[model samples]
Target: MQRVRTAPRHIAFETRPAGKPLDAEWTQITTREFADQVSAFAKGLIASGVRAGDTVMIMAPTQYLWAVVDHAALFAGAVVVPVYDTASPAQLQAIIADARPVLAFTGTAVHGERLAQAATASGTEAPQLRLLDPDPAIPNDASLAGLAELGTTVTDAQLEERRLAATLDDVATIVYTSGTTGDPKGALITHRNLVGQVLNTAAAYSEVVQETGNTVLFLPLTHVLGRALQLICIANGMRVAHLSDPKEVVQSLAILRPTFLVVVPRVLEKIEDAAANSAREKKVLPLWRAAHRAAVAWGVHLEAMDRDPGARAPLGLRLRHALFDRVFYGKLRAVMGGRIDYLLSGAATLRPELARFFRGIGVPVIEGYGLTETTAPLTGGRPGSLVAGSVGTPLPGNAVRIADSGEVLAKGVGVFAGYRNPVHTEQAFVDGYFRTGDLGSLAPDGTLTLRGRLKHVIVTSTGRTVSPESWEQTVEQHPLVAHAALVGTDRPYLTALVVIDTEAATAWFRDRGDAPARALTEDGLVVCADGRLTEEISAAIHRANAAVSPSERVQAWEAVVIGEDRASEFVTPTMKLKRQALLDEAASITDGLYR
Candidate 1:
């Protein structure tokens, strides 16, 4: 808040006014103006009887207003509880029953109505509802603007006092897990936890602050990584743009031309696909493939030299890499607004091949690892000190170690306090370190390579224990596969449920002029009406199986194409497949495979 007051010209977010061309000049709000808005919103909460420690629910999409309300709630000395906008009614009811927030901010009319219905169904009074973006057409509900109007009644002195009253140990947020196994448990995050994230991120990636002029954040603010970046930007007084709709990302990137980005692997994969498709369309597939190979080679050489500064790239490879930079890499850079220096990837493990490809193109992607319980990232790759396959060293004051059982345990200032359910909280910690439940090994150099979730390990009937993550990683690398989940739990052999990348698969078929209009449905089968599509999937499975050990190989598999019927069949919002959910959904398919 003080930083905002100091840097008045620092652009916070770009606002595209209604009825204007997207390419038109964006309305810029400085830190000073944004601070005032936050202060006003904070005052409104206080005027509405919200007090210190009061739980305020922010159930909305990623937008500037979401950040405003989030900061406002915190400034009002309230503990925030973020609810995913896509959460089911029962999930909403469960959250409402648990936290019972004094106030709730909804993204749209549909979300507001869902909350009201969920509250009524749960037999609990609904929190004071305010629409983040109220439609004038439907003026029945309260608006965020109205809430801000209420804030004008409170004086600045009172607001300042309340903001200053918060301490480091105070509960800042209760972020719920994706709940793949069972009910979602709220992880208690503190002001100290958040502060640690900001300080550590800045220290680790200072180049992101110094050289990168601005950043664009599109990830859901409900997620800790998004929230962490928000705080990092504010702390460093850097310019930022908060993107609301994911569809507008490309346009916004072209318009804002941000220098840095925080994203998931899915975003990069889409960009890579778009670039590859463009090359194929232009009949320059061979040239593009050559350039890609050159880039990966250059990236590998650079990483080798980075590890051992005395090392150097071979003359032939270096010459080819330099040639491609001028011919191919330049065009790829233009796709990302032509100024992106770094792409920080998290939430899901990034494919090293993709990371190398991006780096080969001159846009370095640094991967990180963490969960909601550990705030954002306990360990992340540093900007200048790049590691291709590793989630870099632990943050400044954090410690990451592999247990005898191979689970990754972390002790850090960024670690969450506990779960909202006391018993779960008690179980979450073991010997002072937070049990991440993720399996990984830390190198002597402090780089970490994640294996897979402990609970998601598949134990075959033959007594072979396989971590499906490695196999899934290989399968997803196939151009046709959007998602892959391995299943064998106590079965004879490993089987998989694959989701076809409709666009990529369609293009692949059309390119070959074989059943160009072939389509896949949500039906649980690998063979589409066009057997060629099924053959393509089978070939991909063969590639994946060949990469793993004989015992860990995917022996039998089926494609479960996602559609309206199977809208969130197995994947979480972050695109991580839910092992248990996938198993339950594909029970019949797996049984048939065994028979």
Candidate 2:
């Protein structure tokens, strides 16, 4: 397994079963077949009016079609715009208008029709839309079927020419950010940008991958994290097992047994809660608690062993590992396929307590940071370089600096070529560095310690400033709290609106002999309803507030009883707080405070 410097001639390469190793079954995509599909799709796209430099919008779930559509579009010298399949009609329309795509590849007729209707409603002329189902036998419109039929006649020469003609500077894709404020902006990324990120990431984790051959693909392909993972797999010849449903992640892991997984903090938090709940239900918590104490004791001894390179673990700890396998590590590992080399958590800050706990249990969780504009990751922790509270050193060829105002600025080839709108593009970059809007400082060792977002900072009337994001992260870490939003910019003190983690809250009520009620209402406050706060909850909020300065502490608070699946009034799709929206909804509360 050598490091690959150049992109493969066929972006879709041959993959086959490595029969000798049973675990290598996931690496089954053959280069021949992949090349055939790429060639055929590219020809059909061109035959259907797609041309060089044209834009193609791709809206589909994480599946083989996503890869096909992206590669085919690239081969035809077209810019690709990948949209989340779950995007609202309004969001889809906005992206379509901004990109002004010449064609759209969709997963179903309903989705295509929705896009069409949205375009008509928005009064924007739409491109030719085509839909293809996962099942080949499903009948499609004559136009789409005709394109699909041409797959059989595409030649290898066409794919080769397309690849040869593609320059490193050519725009490969336009990724729209899940806007926290307004319509998402398209970030133009070239082939060089993506390839650089993949290569740099691969280099950072080469040691871990040297011993493992598989990586799990679960993030949305619409996101840069997912797209980067796909490229890394292709560049490194690693196998991928795609999982879309969050509920099926553990089950999929059992089947795929991937060596590594790149996931968001929410996913890891869910696993932690599930494991804890399982332990409690099985009456293993007490025993596991004792085991945890012993594990800590054994950890100290292991540290001593490390001082002597040739030393081995003592007999007592070895016996404990065997005895506690089922109660502790075994169950935890089973949920993660029992074979993960390392887990990379990004997209959001992971609680340090959770990261340390996972590491103590033999699962190393590395927390990192990046954005869509940075092509997913600018910094990540390596094996021994793991930092519990910091997003590790910047990737090779990347430079990170802190502005005077504490904003994190980055410059590198991995940085995107500005937003599609010139005004946004101008505002995004300061000098040549992309202003990340995140406030952070660089450690002596180069690790980036994230504080919070500059734009999200709350300034009190007394002139004290606070980053509500840090408090939000702290509150969300609680088992009962699913999401949190901190408010009070020029008022008395900070207050939060929180959504309970539904499953955890239901179980919490069930254990107390209470029948679970229907989902909480959006914008409905979740106080005691008797107009009193519980001592336990009060203590928790006080503790969270104590972590910040006195002026930043919550003087008053209320929870909105939002339904689990309803359009979140206080949160965005990426789970970012919709601060302005929350402020607007809580106007009555704020006004009452003043009186």
Candidate 3:
């Protein structure tokens, strides 16, 4: 990739509205206006006693206010600590205490008040709190107007002073881990680290603009993927549209007609589900079946085409393209802007079957790997260089190596400075390389294949070290299981704590003449009106478990009802399991096996 010297001057760090004609097509915010808002918010923050280097916590959903508050804190030379919107009060309290923030910006009055109470309960130093709106009024308190009202016009002199004081080496943000595995730790990221990561990512996806012309942003901004993509968009001079609702994505695609997109495995799964259901509804029609088969066949052919550069296209390829374009490709494209040059998937592993299915439908799912600590996207499969099941080669300036124990080690300019806790910072690195804790191999073609996290490995008493993530992925692929965590560390056999997809489970029961007349509830089990495994449900679990090794097979399992009021059970923002909390609550079921 050629390095370009023409960097945009004046930083233009915030969203700027594209001039008229395109104005109504996007949410408009100019660079000057963005700077003024940041300056005003910084002044208000300073008056509230937030000093340089002090942490300012932000716990909010995706909104323009989130972007404003984050940039304001950075401009003020203060470190920003971003908290997930879905985090519980206790989780928020823990992070606030650990970071010892001076002030916090929350999404609503309810969460803001709850945070204050949680801090008091934890006996931690409570920071000054400002409520963002709870009543959902027009232009809520979290709106840009609300923040602008907090202070008067900031002078040019003041802006210059703040800008001059800011340094690239300074700690810009402290993003806490989602705590899916254990306690969350803040990953300390410097300005330079983030800037480098954006530059590197832009280089990899440069073809998206040169080839396709547009990109869409839908991931949560608090996470690394969203954060990094924001910077990449600015640096690449690309237009970005943010959508908070996943359901609105297809509609947005129709309007925006984005050429590229960043997505998670869950979103792709939904798309596949939609397509399959549509096909099933039209199955009775003979022409529908023929069209569907042709589309599926064409999808398979497209996947083959992707694999070989010089493969001759069969004459049937063109015929099917013309025949299936309206019924298949057109619908798929309508849901995805119909002109996407590439679709990038990360945060979790993409099932091989799903990847192939999408590739067959003409949308290439390029899987990548990274963490919050690496500012995301350490490795990505380039447009023409993609391989199934492997996160493509490391980005330029990033190095990847596998340890004897199979732990993946990464070293690069994009690597974060360290975790906020000094002890964790020291422990996370081994001989200067960041110990990713993830186990994976570097393939012969430079692609990276993730095995599982080292800490989550289940070591059987018989001496086999099995990665539950490997098995968990397969289990989750089952239609009934929404999410599954394979548990059984140091045990004879594994046991799964499964969260059944309530929608699919409901349909499964209905088809078997076992639909619940009313809701049935129980601990460690979900039942219809009649008490039983709902027929074939247990069989599905057994079949999923049967696919794994004997030691890794789930011996006993519990059904996780969707709306259960389990306080500490569920994944964190990054989608990692909260193992300690789950194990504690399920101790009775697990303890008997050890005895």
Candidate 4:
């Protein structure tokens, strides 16, 4: 925090209007200005009875204000607790009860009202609420602007004293998990964990973390991954633009021309799909297909060279790729603002195909592995030594090992102290290492290759265990698949419930001039008696099955239509499918597959 404050000449953050191009009139906050705002907010929080150890919850999306308040709370010697704005009222109430924050910040009035209602329902006094953007949608006790005014009288010495009084061992945050398993558990993160994360990330990425660059952060600050990036950007003195809404990311990308990006895999996939769709719309499908094939071939050749430096791409393919790069890859890169030099992806595995395509086109996606409990990254890919399928070696200062049960265990300064639940915390560690509950293996060079979540694995009646995630990754690669879940827990064989990517499927049918099967339904892609679409989907299924072992191959599958409501039921906010939740909701369809 102090380092950023001293770098007054540096633009700390750039806040752009929603839906506007990045160059459109945007507010730039210099490091000095950011520090002043944080100082004033810290004073406001302090004057409002916030003290060391008090929890201050920020229930909002990613934005400049959210970052300010988070820093201010820390400066005021208080613990920060962040809740996802998309969280249900019940989840909100549960977190409120657990953290018992003395003050809370909400991005919008709707969230303010929800928090108020949840507090009332929980029979606890609602925390003093401040709004990031106060509108008439709900009542707010005071606006962040108003709070900043209230804090104008605070002096720098007061803020410094508060900062000095706190130790690294002090609790800094209680980041609640997204609750894919059950109710969310608040993981206790201390000042040390935050510092360790920054230090280790810098060590792992070398200059990537230390060098200043232009970046756009769209990940929710509520998640540890997002929170870590926010802090890292500030600490590294990067010029950053914040996007609260993910939908605007693509448009903003072209305008921002960010040199570096931190993202989830879904965003990359969306970009790939959009690029393909754009090509088709422009009457250049043939060109796009040729470029894609060349990119894949180029990527393969590069990988081979990584293994054997003397290796080279066949001259014919190399020449074709170079020609296509000028025509296709250059245009695609412009969609990402054309300046992206590197990317860091986490939260889930990045598909190797997507990774290869981006790298082949010049923007390398460095996949990393970590969980909420690990404070963001335990393992990360290096700049030039990236292994497509592996999340490169553990970040410096972190040690990873696979347990006898195949669960990954991590011991590091970045690991969280424990969950808020005493018993849960007690069971989370073994021999001082945090049990990640993720199954993975370490390559000879120590790169981590994640397989699946232990709890999400399916065991068939024949005693064959399969990682649904591995199959799902391969299945979802098909353009028509919106989502897929493999099911067969204790059943005879594995089957899948697939959701169609409606727009893509519609385009597929329209392009083929086969319009009349049955309009895509809310129930999902309806199979025609013997239509080309059905045959294509079957072929996709066969391709996915071929990628896995016979025992793990999907035997039977059914496509289920998921309306907006059903979409939420099938996937977590983080985009991870809740296997049990989805299966229970689609019990009839799942059972029919076996019959």
Location of the lowest summed lDDT over 10 successive residues in candidate 4: 521-530
Q: Give the TM-score of candidate 2.
A: 0.87
Off by over 4 Å in 1: 18-21, 134-141, 506-530
Sum up the clashes in candidate 4.
Answer: 2
Give residue 543's lDDT in candidate 4 (0 to 100).
Answer: 82
Angstrom error of the Cα, residue 460, model 3: value is 2.0
In model 2, state the lDDT of residue 444: 81
- Give the Cα error of residue 269 in candidate 3, in Å: 0.8
In the range 17-59, model 2's lDDT, one tens digit per residue, is: 3222323444455445554566677877876778788899888
Q: Give the winner by TM-score: 2 or 4.
A: 4
lDDT of 4 by residue, 1-595 (tens): 6665467778888887655665698887898888888888898887777888899999888888888899999999999999988787788889888889899998877887899999988887899989888444443237766676676677778778987788888789999988777788999999999999987686666557553677888888888988898787788787788887778888888877788899888778878887788888889999898888888778777777777889978889989989998998988888888888889988888888788888888888899988899998888888768878788888878899999999999999889999999999999999999999999998888889998889988888999878888778877877777778888988999988877666677777777787734536545323333355556778778888898888888878877555553455556656666667667777877788888
Predicted candidate 1 versus true structure: per-residue lDDT over 1-595, tens digit per residue: 6675566767766766644666877788888888888888899999888999999999998877888899999999999998888787778889989888888988887888898899899988888888887466645337877778788889999998999898999899999887777778989999999998888878888887652378887888888888888888878866777776665777677678888888889888888877778888899999888988888888887788777888888899888888888877887788678998889899988988889999988899988888898898899888667888789989887889889999999998889999989999889888999999999998888889988889988888888888888888888877778888888888888888787777677678778886643346344333343467667667778888888888888767776665544444456666666667767766887787788
lDDT, residue 157, candidate 3: 69
lDDT of 3 by residue, 194-236 (tens): 8788777777777874322556566778898887877676556
lDDT of each: 0.82, 0.72, 0.70, 0.82
Clashes of each: 0, 7, 4, 2
Q: After superposition, how far is residue 396 of candidate 2 from its true place, in Å?
A: 1.1
Regions of model 2 farther than 4 Å from truth: 1-28, 135-146, 151-154, 210-212, 289-326, 518-536, 568-574, 589-595
RMSD (CA, angstroms), candidate 2: 4.8
| Model 3: per-residue Cα lDDT at residue 213 | 53
